[model samples]
Target: MIQVEGLTKRYGERTAINKLTFHADKGEIVGFLGPNGAGKTTTMRILTGYMPPSEGKASVAGFDLLTQSLEVRKRVGYLPENVPLYPEMSVVQYLDFMAELRQVPNRNERVDEVMEVVHIADRAESFVSNLSKGLRQRVGLAQALLHKPEVLILDEPMEGLDPQQQIEVKRLLREVGAAQTVMLSTHILAHAQELCDRVIIINGGQIVAEDTPDRLSAQIAGGRRLQLEVDGDGDGLLAELRALPGLSSVRVVADGRFEIETAPGPDVRPLIASTVVGGGWKLLELRRERLSLEEIFIQLTREEAEAAAAAETGAPLAEGQAPGSDSAAG
Candidate 1:
């Protein structure tokens, strides 16, 4: 478990992170998502005791970050964006060194366990310099898990690997996250959408949004379309549905299928079902379409940037107004 409150970091007059606050519950996999220069790495460093925050408070595994840095570090396993590894050391040798440095009991056994977890036991004898980028990443992960920390803090764990390797790492993270808390920062939206139970989106040194992937998607998209399959001609049904209150638009997809768009509100399936059954049409299936995480991320970040710009220029944003243009917000 982890908690942060009012976490701020500054270098000279430039602020990297400003008043960041969030929490990762025990056994929860929370994704830390942001674009370049969004203070993700800065926040991770403060959490890992790699650097102290300029102001704020934090706790890791129930230990105070400021007063108990060592205890917090002991419970956290960190894999940085650019892994710091000894190129000349063999996989087994490097893990052994890390285990010893952490003062882990039964160092050999722990090393073997982590090597197996990351599927790098076969490369135990290979030098770090000789392994492929993916294998090297595995080695980095193994070291992080060597101590059996309660919390895993990963920065870009899937950054440079091939597709297959990325899949493999995601599987490993899922397996580990089943028992330990995981806080990972990644640029890959699809990966986050697949692996994270909750996502925190940050921009301009502040948190712009935080919620489950599904909720965030629905919130940004505002409304969704419904797909229906019936056992009769859909032309009559389409016209009738379009005439329903709160129904925005209706289109026939095929001889027996239709797509219905609705205004943002409660589910309209009950009304649609009653109308179909009452009219002697068989309602086979009805499903609502949801937006993808990519679409949600783009819309949320762009809105945040536009709001900031509006504030700076003292421009009044109209009620219910959407963002003006598609700019690279990140």
Candidate 2:
């Protein structure tokens, strides 16, 4: 488990993290997502006790990050975006050394276990310098797991890998996630959407959104849409559909098709079908139109920028935080 309160980090005059607050429960895979220069790496470093925040406090596995830095370091496994390695050391030797560095008891068993976990046991005897990029990444992961830390702080863990290697690393992360709290920071929205139970999207050194993928998408897009095609004058039929409760806006598109928004937490397809039949219109097609994660990400980023500008001008953000939603800006 991890907790951060009013976490703020600054370098010179620029603030990298501004009053950021969030928490991840045990056995949960929480994705940390943001655009470039969003302070994701900064936050990870502070949590790992590699750096100190300029303000606020944090804890990992019930240990204070500031006062109990040593305990926090012992409980967190950190895999930096660019994993530091001793290229001269063989795979087995590197892991063995890391195990010892962590003061892991039974270092031999721990080294062997992690090597197998990351599937680099075959190259145990091979020097790290000779391994491919994918293999090297695996080695980095193996070293991180060598001590069996309670929490994993991985920054861009899937970066620079081919599709096959990405899949392999993703599978390994999922397995590890089942037993430890995982805080993965990456720019890949699709990967986060697939692997995370909840996503924290930060922008301009602050949290702009945080929720499950489904909830986040619905919140931004104002709920999902249902596209329908019926054999009739779609114009009047669109109006009739809009008149129904739980149905919001309706647009009649080309080819007798209509795009409609439905109320949250309700299935309006059956009602639409019945309405079409009553209107003497034959149904042709009907299905939900879900937005891609990329679209959602773009929309959220733009919104955050606009909100930040509004704040600078002393204007209230038209869409500050939705009810029951956490939204912040620089």
Best by lDDT: 1
lDDT score, residue 67, model 1? 94
lDDT of 1 by residue, 9-70 (tens): 99989999999999999889999998888999999999999999999999999999999999
TM-score of 2: 0.84
lDDT of 2 at 173: 88
**C-alpha RMSD values across all candidates:** 6.4, 5.6
Question: Each candidate's lDDT (Cα)?
Answer: 0.84, 0.84
Q: List where candidate 1 sits over 4 angstroms from the true fold.
A: 214-223, 236-243, 251-256, 271-282, 312-330
- Winner by TM-score: 2
Name the lDDT value of residue 291 in candidate 1: 62
- The 10-residue segment with the lowest total lDDT in model 1: 321-330
Q: Write the per-residue lDDT of candidate 2 for residues 213-307, one digit (tens) a residue.
A: 87776555543477788776665786788788888788877757888876664556678888987888888877666566677778777877776
What's model 1's lDDT at 155? 93
